[model samples]
Target: MTVSTATGPLRPRVRFTGLARLSPRAGVVASASLIFILVMSLVLPAVTGYGPDQFVDLPYQAPSLAHPFGTDGFGRDVMVRTFAASRVDYLIPLLIVAISVIIGCVVGVAVTLIGGFAEWIMMRVTDAIIAFPFLILILALVVVFGQTVNVPFLPNGTIPIIVAVVLTGWAYYARLARSQTLSLREMDYITAARIMGYSTARIVFRHITPKVLGASVSYAIGDLIVVMGLIASLSLFGAGIAPPTAEWGQMMFEGRSVLDQYWWVTVFPLLFIIVSAVSLAAIAERLVARLEGRTQ
Candidate 1:
């Protein structure tokens, strides 16, 4: 029943009508910053002709036109490595969050649809997972799985970390999805679908899912940055992507020892993390507003 926009009705159970004009200029800045990071991380590494591990200059060289972010302890270009790290730092969380959302929405909707004993058991299980100290749980899981797990094309510890984060992260989305589904089920479209003899699957998928999904997406956008930080934090504990592979956390961990004399190594990587996270956050803020019809 709450599907209409301020102007008029859009679609039943669909909160989204169409794109809103983003009033905030911050969105453009955020988008540009994100684009720069993507280009630096994904494209220019090849153009620069420097491997992230390549010792291109004397170690600890200060920033220059040749080496804009200077060089680190191993003479690896700090600029290249920082951006290169984004490939892992950025992509991993996006992947983890995406998988979590899929699993969560399925579990959430399923539990509600099933009802009774099975639903009770699953919600209890989800609660248990969510109640635990998430970081410690992820660390322990990463360590346990990383020892035995390796996948082709994935960096070391990548698969294990993904497995660990997703294992814990999905519970959150499930709770969100379940709450959304509970409200949506009371809406007229769902009641009509039930009365019309539409298959349970059709009603749920066609009607409920589109509506429930928006909430999950809104919930998860901010989590992408959270998961990125988590992965970077893990690297500091010696459980990240391993040495020689440039990860922002790993770079920061290595640079901290010499940071008193060499600020570039630590500061540059940390700055990238900050800028990227801030950009993402800005985008998410406007996007959520855009979704909720709060924006002009």
Candidate 2:
């Protein structure tokens, strides 16, 4: 309440902290979308009862209630194949983000903590990697590696793409983490830790690392969908996972040849990619917004 002698009623000052500052609408939509994506990508695919390679009908049949996505040239259900592709499509990006974050954070944190020539060298290396057009490098690596690599355990295309993407992917997060860490170095507590003669490892790990990692990891979550798109796009150039694997890009590539005559083959997979991408992207976009809000 305003003081009785006050000239006018005082307005309530808004505090931008915690939940109050975040958008309820965005939070709700993101939660629902995450649940939907998890269910569709993980749960529904398991229960579909059609293997991506199984023959289900005559080749090139039109879409119907039974086969919602129609039959492909090999008589496989296109819808089932699209769902099956989730293992390849989603998993690669998930692994990429997780691996990148781990490798990047270690390198980033070390370089920032070390200082001097070590830091200078690593930063230059990361900068050089980052300076390249990201997509071009990853694609180039994938194409080159796909030809020469032969491993009994890994699929032909998977190994090459993973190597290519990871080679370039971690550098981005390393740079980002370094930038975040540089700011932390100037903070009073970090300076005090140095003045107090705290061990480098102890000070960085105990005080500074937590603060640096939270932001990097949160931002990494938003980067997931972008990585997924890049992996999917690989199939467009016939450089992704080979046939019989049920990847979305491969499906789209094959379907494109017959798109005019048999539209469902191409349309359904495209629709799946669009719907899933949009859904996952909604979550990513909101998270990034909230993160920006935190910084501000």
Candidate 3:
């Protein structure tokens, strides 16, 4: 007796184009490094015994195996303080960046949906905000709100600073989104959709939003570094992160007094700030190229 076994059908094969097959090598490396640094920032605090303000060494000690990054003017372990400080410093820019994107996207979509004199007025308002020096804008807000205020969620005043940054930062994204929308609004496809009786809301959210997001996302990534720098500058100037926080900017400020002795105190924080900023910008550069559909 001859018996034949039944077999299941095979799955479809997947293929990739040249561009899709190749990955952004530089961006991947930069992103990986940044992620590693962020993770270390969290985990390092656990193994260390000293806190940011808990001094444990002779003041102004240079780099040693016991201290690693050495002791600051207050005799605090630099490594421990840096790790502890990461929680605040890192989160501030991350929060600001996220808030900025949300505000920008909303304002951009709104300006596009409602055009004419209203759009002009809103655009001008955005321009006015953007025209102010970034640090000056932040300082102005910090002074008015007393640097820290109670928020519905977060107990710390950092939320207030994040809100202020977001408020002023969205203008550029709005302008960019509006320009792209203006060009897209007059497209033949949009005209067809309009003629087909599609609702304005549907067109804006369903069709326009996705297309404009590419530009806005690219813009937001680039803007984050600028925001972080402004935050650091404010912290250095005593307009940000109140006492007891081991922020990089505050560290820099503290280092200024002991520059002749404890260079590591200042150097390490500056190095951290620079590395974080550069890694982000490097990734952003690759992303911008990808978003614009450009090749090597």
Candidate 4:
């Protein structure tokens, strides 16, 4: 006679072991790196004795126990300036992303929901904006506006950059949201909501927007790294944040003159930029992977 088999709830088994765990491990490390950078940026100013523009050291001083990242050509501590620059380097992209996402999602959802002429006009406008070369358009706006508009809270010189970036950046999100909305609008749940006599606004907001937002958000994460680079490039070209601001691009520009002798001046800023971009990019990748259900 066969022994009676016992049937019970199955135990959960390990899904990832050894090499299979690398992706999650990398994601954790990337997240940790991002958090560390953000925390250091926020906390360093309070804890460190030297201010970003404080010139307590000799010009082009090499890295030392006293001045960790060395001094710039102006005799200012590189470490302090790097930390100070972190504020804008982080802030501008964040602001750009926020503004773009809001405007884009609203316009995209509205146009898609309304359809017909409104959608046509908005699509044409978006196409026109997209037709222009990205960097050139930003430069044109900055140059045309003369880069001196005084916004309430932002730095005096940053108004044009913000305006330009926001104007240019939002189109991408709008297009993305529209594409997602078009597809999501046809889903069974959306049709069911319509059949259930839900108002158009409720159906779009409650049902469609959330699904579209996920993809848009993933794109925004990747776009942050790009926006940061663009800001740095603008500063490098003398069109972004001005001097005395301790921005990474400006810092690198200042150090270019004596790069051979005083490598740390430029090197530190460059290193910081690279690290910031890489960390953001890694986080974006993980986010996209998780959104796509590829993450284990």
- Measured on C-alpha atoms, candidate 2 has an lDDT of 0.68
Summarize candidate 3's per-residue lDDT along 1-296 as a digit string, tens digits.
Answer: 01111111121211122333255575676688777877877777676755668879898888999899999887889988876666666677777877776676667766677788877787777767766566665567667776457665342446546766777777666666677777888889889988999987788878887887766665566666776676667766567766666778878887988787778998998888887776776677676667769853
Better of 2 and 3 by TM-score: 3
Winner by lDDT: 1
- Indicate the TM-score of model 3: 0.83
How does each model score on TM-score?
A: 0.87, 0.79, 0.83, 0.86
Model 1: CA > 4 A from native = 1-23
- Model 2 misplacement above 4 A: 1-27, 41-48, 133-155, 195-197, 294-296
User: For candidate 1, lDDT tens digit of each residue in 105-173?
Assistant: 777777776678977886777767766676676678776776346677667778778877888887776
List the candidates ranked by TM-score, beginning with the highest.
1, 4, 3, 2
RMSD of each: 6.7, 10.2, 13.3, 11.1
Candidate 3 weakest ten by summed lDDT? 1-10
Best by TM-score: 1
Better model by TM-score, 1 or 2?
1
Question: What is the Cα-based TM-score of model 1?
Answer: 0.87
lDDT against the true structure, per candidate, is 0.76, 0.68, 0.69, 0.74
**Model 3 vs truth, CA RMSD:** 13.3
